[model samples]
Target: MTTALTLTTGQDQDGAPVLVAAGEIDMSNAERFTAALSEAITDRREPLVVDLTAVEYLDSAGLAALFHHADRIEVVTGPLLSPLLAVSGLADLTTVRTR
Candidate 1:
């Protein structure tokens, strides 16, 4: 079965666009994740903050989605997912912080 995921849009303290995601991001829902990122990026036209602290799993497809939008986004994830982001080389392309 496909894993559960939720994507919510909002603004940060500085009024920058933010996309808060919860649950797993795998091939089953990677497309939806990418679409959300695309929408946030297109609508805001600025660096979007992606909050993934509550996400439990992210597969290669999810990573690919992030890479596709690497230039226009920052990532905030928990320690569990930090190493994956760093090892995926996404940390080099954009800002990724662990919380």
Candidate 2:
């Protein structure tokens, strides 16, 4: 079964779309995560910010969803997930800033 996951949407001070994700993101729940992200994507051309500050884990499937939309997304993450994103080459594909 998929582990617990939560996703919330908001806008940044600059009015850019933001997606805040919490909990583990793995194969089982990657589709849900992708759906949340897709739903949050707005018409604005500005890149979407995916805030991964509360995410505890992320697997390949989870990373793939982010990769698929790398051109339109940036990410805010924490130390726990930094290394994984780095080695997965996601950092190169999209912007990733550790918070």
lDDT of each: 0.94, 0.92
lDDT (Cα) of model 2: 0.92
Residue-level lDDT tens digits of model 1 in 1-99? 555999999999989999999999999899999999999884566699999999999999999999999999999999999999999999999999999
What C-alpha RMSD separates each model from the true structure?
A: 1.5, 1.5
Report the CA-based lDDT of candidate 1 relative to the real structure: 0.94
After the best TM-score superposition of candidate 2, give how far the Cα of residue 15 lies from its true spot, in angstroms: 0.7
* Residue lDDT tens for model 2, 22-88: 9999988899999988888877889999999999989889999999888889999999999998998
TM-score of each: 0.93, 0.93
Candidate 2's displacement at residue 56, Å, is: 0.4
Total backbone collisions, model 2: 0
What CA RMSD would candidate 1 show? 1.5
**49 Cα displacement, candidate 1 (Å):** 0.1
CA lDDT of 51 in candidate 1?
98
